[model samples]
Target: MSEMHELFLTCPKGLEGLLADEAGVLGLAEVRQSTSAIRGRASLETAYRLCLWSRLANRVLLVVSRFAMGNADELYQGVHAVDWADHLAPSGTLAVEFSGHGSGIDNTHFGALKVKDAIVDRLRSASGERPSIDKLNPDLRVHLRLDRGQAVLSLDLSGHSLHQRGYRLQQGAAPLKENLAAAILVRAGWPRIAAEGGALADPMCGVGTFLIEAAMMAADIAPNLARERWGFSAWLGHVPALWRKLHSEAQQRAEAGLTRPPLWIRGYEADPRLIQPARNNIERAGLSAWVKVYQGEVATFEPRPDQNQKGLVVCNPPYGQRLGDEASLLYLYQNLGERLRQGCLNWQAAVFTAAPDLGKRMGIRSHKQYAFWNGALACKLLLIDVVPTQFVTGERTERSHAHEHSDTGQGTAGEHPPAPAPAAPARLSEGGQMFYNRLQKNHRQLAKWARREQVECYRVYDADMPEYAVAVDLYRYWVHVQEYAAPRSIDPEKAQARLFDALAAIPQALGVDPRHVVVKRRERQGGTRQYERQGREGRFLEVSEGGVRLLVNLGDYLDTGLFLDHRPLRLRLQQEAAGKRFLNLFCYTGTATVHAAKGGARSSTSVDLSHTYLDWARRNLSLNGFSDKHRLEQGDGLAWLEENRETFDLIFVDPPTFSNSKRMEGVFDVQRDHVRLIDLAMARLAEGGVLYFSNNFRRFVLDASLLQRYQVEEISASTRPMDFARNDKIHRAWRITAR
Candidate 1:
């Protein structure tokens, strides 16, 4: 009978169950599970087979001896009890790893030293020569664990973690370890899907970890087949014949698996830099024929597999770790969900993410959720079936029969008409109904005023109810909902629930498609955070205000290019400026400058620090057929005002409340720098010319000293349009002129 050796297979946390099942299948006896490890008994052949076959295990250790120990002396004695002659020659090199901290061995290094000393002493006394220590690539590697005063010593049968696989020498930032990637694929049921001749794809494949792992699993290729050296290779008791037999079998199986029809496996990565590296990894894995990678973004990702093939879509999208990262990632997840719905019908999907709340915004229902740990961060694996039933659709409106007819202008002739669009629940919750009623009331009141005033964009709701703390704005056909960050006193779950309710009611109340509604979380921004980009969609929509066209990017920026609350001020600039020199400071997107140019300003200069916004200002001016005369200067506003040698008849100064932009020499606080800012603009003010200064700091106090130097009149109320009537502190404006 073959000897049965006790074995321990260590895998990543949360994969013990799967590893245990695998061990039992590989002919291990009495399989047992523990945290990050599986314990079982196997013959030497089975042990070798496991080392080659395990897709999820990190290392496989073969138990050599177990004994009771009370202190370091006992530890030495127990290790010395093992017959060294059977495992290692006296001149052979060895290494030791110690774990746990009991039996008077408080430090791992001390515990390892004791074990090493005992082995060397026993060997040296018998053979007159001692084994040398080689930490890397040792002939014999030993591991000792002190558990509740009992020492269990084992030989490391799998050298260097099995997850290395020898294929991925290069990877991207935050790459998933191979074993964890395998576990994700296993939980995602990639094996079953692959066996059915289905395809696989990864949208955000960083270095193609998932694609290569999935390909190896489908092709019946042993993960460690290409490994040249192992922990037991140089051991005295190593059985080369048994390992060779298993290796031969794996090779034959791989050959056979490859001879069959190839499964379509592909990866798409957004970063062009990772494309060649991912392809290199695929080639190293010997799966270039089956797996391919391309440089593509999630927004345009489409898996073009063989006809009639349906399989899995899996990816580990970045769950941001920095502030304001989640806000931008919302659109990424939304885009991914949109792609899955529009392109990959009747398929399966698994999204492994650390941010489960962002996953909720994907607009799809995950049928099952499994919790796992990627390093120390707790993550969730969302398993979804991309069938029609899993899609989250908005409330359906009644359509006329003529609209439902085919584009050929004929009723169904022979082919079946496409399925009617899915509809959400018609009845809303009580809270949602109340919110919808309030939105309808606000829209009715604001819609008439907006149409009468020729306003295409305006605010409709501004935290009307304490429970639903979100502002909803209408941009023609699109809806922009900004959810105010709830205070710490409110339960986050409750706040999220209220937000979901409000979102469900927004499209219905505003008479817009749900897809046109963009949602963002509004928190108090510090420094230049508000100006920083939140997304990369780069989609700019052209809208008109006061007979002038302006471009607004609703997805890429936190604040759309045009400020809805500042409409009145922009209109006033247009109404008051005629053949006058206009100067606009802190001209974000230069909406005010556009208005001034449209109102027949002789010449205008827009000053800002950001070149990106200055370009945007240039575009805004060009859109209105006034470009050469409108000089767009990119510099610090205060510095530009100081260096100017000219004066203007109309000047609009709307500075941020706080800015610590990197372009500036120092921080600029509106409250602290307003005096200098006003003094500089007042100097640039031509005689008898008007200067309109405004800011949005709620508690801002006008400098009392400026009251005595100039003729100043507060026009905050008059400048605030009707849309912002409810929020009296939205902004403060003053009309100033030379005394």
Candidate 2:
């Protein structure tokens, strides 16, 4: 053993074997799988190679020292005892991470600090100069893991989080961690699947992590091809020539779109919440065409129109396996089973579920029970094969490969939920198409409310802009603005004329006045669909329809003043402000003030930190004939509210979820300083008066219990609009009255 180095690679819980396999591929000898990690012995070059190629590892570590670090003193002494000049110097940068211990030396930050002190002090005393810490992207990342009075220290060879594989330009909420994703693919026998060019399907593919990873493998693309940096590249004795060769080989494998053709991979989700994140990650992965996420449901999904090969349809669903209402989950799984059995016969199906009970409702005997863990919960993967007659398909071609070894178990085949399952009869109207009627039905229910809300929001639009642009002000809906290279066949002029006509015909469409319709336009830049990117690439502003409100800020973006998230807060103002004075601070375009005025407030004052918004507020008031009637002031909201000792019966306070307005005294964090803001706003509330405060932070917490100064009752229920029915608590809505 010519200079043996102790080392371990941290895997995300269940990816040990896969990570070990990757190391073995990279020429590491004596690679052994551990519980949530892997241990391997290799030369420094082997560690660097493994770092460059390992797809399922969080990070690869080169052990420096290990001891029973029970407290900070033990941690400091354990770290300081290492020879300082070996890998670190006063001029080099460093970073540290610690975990696994529940207390004592287990605190990640505390452990990290102590380790930092040890390294810096050791270097300072030896060389009279100390290396600095580079938290953003360190030259050296130190990891310390402790368990049951034992500690392990390793230098991270893999740079950044291995999850940033460089392929995703978009992501979904609670996205499958990259390590977890890799493990899922491996456990589903991706080696066998990849050899046969099988498809991966994610019915509830939040952000398309699994589909992207699988497609990357099928395309022979290097998962790290798009990544910018790696820890091995920053190693003291880093090999630039070897890294370049590895990178070039991976780059040569990258391809756009699906190489196998037809549909080898697909993902579907009903909630729009996952849409943007999914798009971002897909764009980042540069696999937009090979793997795409569609806004859809799984229950009635049909096979691809051009699928002629036997592919696998594997999915992770919201069977309360991780995040969802557990009670409503079993039925969803049953519906998924119905889709697989009735819609896909020539395909192999694998369902991964922590709730094996819910998996049983699929009513298909599992061929293999592969064990895994997502976070800490023990999970199982159930693979199945169905006979062609068991499927209800109107086929046009033959199966590419014969199913020789389905191995669907010989079991009782009737494990299900106790309560009667939902109507999952494997039948759908219109040739098994999804019930899109639900979306339309919800839109229908909110038609009246939408009309009213649009009217108030429109009060902020400039009415003097060009006809095409001004048409955007009258009504908010039925408007689409795109800045892109249009095909010759798609006439922009004709589209504009048609959209204008639609605006004029709004009354006929919805039995409401057409004058109430608002239409606006802005520019968009053409996107390289290879990245699934859809953004207005150039500068454009919300232009009024009739050249009345000539918004001159057309050099940057689309609809800057408006976001639909705060619709409920605006409604709350309109609901509770009758016969009361209202203060609309930070009033961008006086939309809230307009709603308050419309709700019959005695007086409404609109103030904003921006002179542009204040001017827009004046124009909006003039457009609605309230220019002189409404007090429009330009000032900092906090300062203005603080200086004036005035109280209102009704107050609407909705601030930017996060901002650092130099105009203000300090940076604002809604989560951390909500109480201070609320107290300040509530100071202006009169006795028995209602104060409506809301934020779209999604995770904002209001210490209402600590506010013995006021009686807080959630008014989010009262402000629920039809557009936000899917997720009512998308924002926290609360009403407080002086106790």
Candidate 3:
């Protein structure tokens, strides 16, 4: 019988079993799993096989000698006793690493220093020469791991970290460590997701790391497919023939497992800077053909209009807490909630964030929140239901603007802002399912009503989807209501096709030429834009209310470009815009910009942080021919107001529920900073100026004391438009004037 060789391997914590399993699968002998390690005896072939195939392990160590040691000195003696000259030439370079624990060793560095000293000492004594240390790329590597006073030293058969899988050619801003990424995927049960036809997505897919990794898993591709170097390449016992065979086998298996088109993987980012990086990384990972990266805003991001089946959306948004931008983060999350409720009802989502509280701002109770680490920061990956929101149907009247007075002297221009907001949309339901069911019923009823009454463009939902809280658009044609249902598959092409159908139908329904209807879709509101994609082309931006020709193209934003939920707010702005100096704060793309200008606003000022949105506001204004009269300011909403108190008869203050724009001196969270903001805006108020401060922070509270110097009128009811007349206040748009 052939002789068996003794070997030991090292892996990351919790991965020892995987290595042992690999060894056994490769037909090795006596495989065993230990803490951060795997040990076994095998022919040289088994060692090569383990090196080529094991995915979870870090290094495949070839055991040279095993012995007991009480302390560092004894450890040095055991290592020094090995015949170092036999394997490494006197001219070769060597490196040593130490890990694990021992009370006496004190530090891994000190322990490694001792090991290095012993190896050199032994080599010098035997061959009168010693190999030099080359930590960067050592020819012969040594690993010494000691735990609880026990020591195990082995030859590092794998040279570099196993995670340096050659697939990645470039990295983007803060690319995730490959090992950490694999850990995330494994933690999410990637293997299982792939098997069951489950999907994967990265909302802020900086460089497509997650996307490519997802594709690799779906294709059954080995994580090390792109790696050209292996520790065994330099090991004394390397078997090139065995490695070649193993490589061929992995290739064959991966190829056999690859899935066909309608690839269940996607990625998106609003910045163009990220688009190329994501593509380059995926291409390097050999997943470019299978995975794709799209450019758009988070607020406007949409899945292909046709794709309907739900998958998973995983994202790692910055921790707003570090910068106190929780409010904006909250706004972003609230919008995310809206998007999930509307667009991704059949999907599941996981958001990794350092602040769980920030995650709470999402307004959905996560099913599970897993803890993980990024660098040294503690983070949580919240697992959530990607369906519409379900709220208790009552107590929603808070955000309505009905209570405020809209007496902007001109009736064309509102008095100072309207009174504080009224209640929000009513929760009318319990589970998300119930909310969606009720909405579906409402849509059916509305469609029936529109048909029977022959009302063209009758409202489907006037207020926000408090019950199934998300953005939705319903239009009627020649008085026929158009239906935009989610596609049946997670296929992009199919989804695009469905979108095209909706796109074709919108023009006919809206009483506009087909060319005028810009077709767009959103993955989730306040997300990236699903612009004129390959499947559906053109802009879906024209809207009309009461023949007023309200220009809205949800395709232009993650936010439906219209905020149908905020219909009352726009109407309020419209009624007072004329003849008044209107100020729009956090003016996204400026639907408010357009409304204010066209409503007879004498001169309008729009402030926002995103240049992209500022440009969009410009477009909207120009489209309405209000560009000459309106001025768009590129600055932070809060900071701009702090310095520029230009009071007007009509002022709109809707700072993000939270914001972290660098240009701003500090973070602005509508919840904590509203009072100060209201004060500042009111200070500049032309005595009669009506300051309307609205925010989407669901639980935002007003500092009545802050407004004490002024007459605080509860104008929520008066401010809430007819569309928003149904129930609760999703926002608190108020009116304030000096007493």
Best by lDDT: 1
Measured by TM-score, the strongest candidate is 1
Q: In candidate 1, what are the lDDT values of residues 569-641, reduced to their tens digit?
A: 9999998888999999999999999999889999999999889899998998898898878898888889898
lDDT by residue for model 2 (265-346), tens: 7777667677667777776776677766666555545544344656677777754322113323543665677667656666
- By summed lDDT, the worst window of 10 consecutive residues in model 1 runs over 400-409
Model 3 C-alpha lDDT per residue in residues 1-739, reported as the tens digit of each score: 6457778776665545545765687766788878667788887766766666566567778777767777878988988898886777677788888987674787899999999999888777454777799887887888887767777778887678676677666666666666556656665666677777776767577777778767877787877765776655665556678778878888897777664553567776655776776777777776767787776445444553346555777776755432113223543554455455545666777777776754654556687766665656767777877544531123222221221222211111111211222112222212333433444555566566555544334344322333222223454221111123343545644433333323222322232322222222223222112222122212444556422444444332334445555655676788777789888887876877677776888988888777866776777676666769688888876678777947777887777766555566666667778877777787777856787767766677787686557777666666554434465565666777788
- In order, the Cα lDDT scores of the candidates are 0.86, 0.61, 0.61
- lDDT (C-alpha) at residue 430 in model 3: 29
lDDT of 1 at 200: 93
**643, model 1: CA deviation in Å?**
10
What is candidate 1's CA lDDT for residue 336? 83
TM-score of each: 0.72, 0.51, 0.51
Q: How many residue pairs in model 3 have overlapping backbones?
A: 91
- By TM-score rank, best first, the candidates go 1, 3, 2
